[model samples]
Target: MIRLPASIRAACVLAVVSALAACANRAPTQFYTLLAPAEATPVPAESGYAIELLPVVVPEQVDVPQLVLRSGSGALQPVDTRRWAAPLGEELRTALSARLSARLGVRDVYRLASPASLPLYRVRVRVGRFDSVPADYALLDAGWSVERRDDRSVRTCDARYREDVGAGIDALVAGHQQALARLADDIAATLRRFDAGGCPDTRT
Candidate 1:
């Protein structure tokens, strides 16, 4: 077997090393960025109808079924674009409390267990869909509904609101918050009706 000269072999080795160094130094193409938590602008009270929220009823399939979206095939993933916020239930509860308190002028808007709460109404939310599509750039979808315990009436048209969120958790949070804002408006409307005696008595 014929062997290459020492100088040529050294030159070839240097070329291979230089190529590897270039490859290593190249800019990364798999760009992945996580979004920061969104700041909530507190809603000011509007109607003076105080209400306390009950523990939200989340679907049974997820660990925090109240926050993440699960697929039909049982894939549990976050739909909220904001990964830094509280779980879906808690976040929704806090957001709703802020908005409702601002609109209704509730003395204390809190979870069900808060003491000294006055004439507090109960709000229940049901999530219908929440998940992400990993293919073709991650896409998030979240659906939800809210209701009052006193009347057994459903809002969200059967917990059905959908938002196509971006890949960032903050984007997801925005989407979820938007849906909740819509839901809170519906609930607030109903609460106003209740206050105005517009709701019919079902006792009959």
Candidate 2:
């Protein structure tokens, strides 16, 4: 071993300690974790007829690969350390399926690609905003419309929902579930109206 100057030894020790300290000060990689919605409940099928949720068409404006998080200070954050799945269409599809299955006595919901020729009504949604707000809450604004197969009319509806929870992606996830539930109910109500109308051609 070669003899080192005292200043050089001190500098080396300080450098090593500084690096360790820097690492300690850094935040570990955060990951995406889902917190299930607390108010979710299954809907009993009011009508004997079973309905399937056609593949939802997510609008391009609402199309995002990852559900971004915003800190209290207004900084954008990612869901997981790794990149999130592209085109949140699948995520929404699964969420809607779960909600509908719980509320309705049916679980036959499938993507738009499903090979089912059943007489199911299709729900189309346009998400305007899905994000976290200040005060540790999440906000969702959407415009939705539903139409029966072979119908030219659409019953349009819109709603804004909010979920209050602690910060992070959990709030966003919970809020999303809440919003979807409301949308489902609205759509269900619309379907009920159509079914009760003696299958009238109320296309608009």
> Number of the top candidate by TM-score?
2
Worst 10 residues of 1 by lDDT: 133-142
- TM-score of candidate 2 versus the correct structure, residues matched by position: 0.59
Q: What is the C-alpha RMSD of each candidate to the true structure, in Å?
A: 15.7, 13.9
Model 1 regions more than 4 Å off = 1-48, 65-74, 77-84, 109-119, 132-157, 195-204
Give candidate 1's TM-score: 0.50
**Each prediction's TM-score against the native?**
0.50, 0.59
Q: For candidate 1, lDDT tens digit of each residue in 2-103? A: 444545534443443344346545533221112223436555544434465654554454334223433334445432221333454555566666666655
- Candidate 2 clashes: the total is 8
Off by over 4 Å in 2: 1-46, 50-52, 55-65, 71-87, 107-118, 150-152, 195-204
Root-mean-square deviation of candidate 1: 15.7
Cα lDDT tens digits for candidate 2, 99-122: 555665554544334334445566
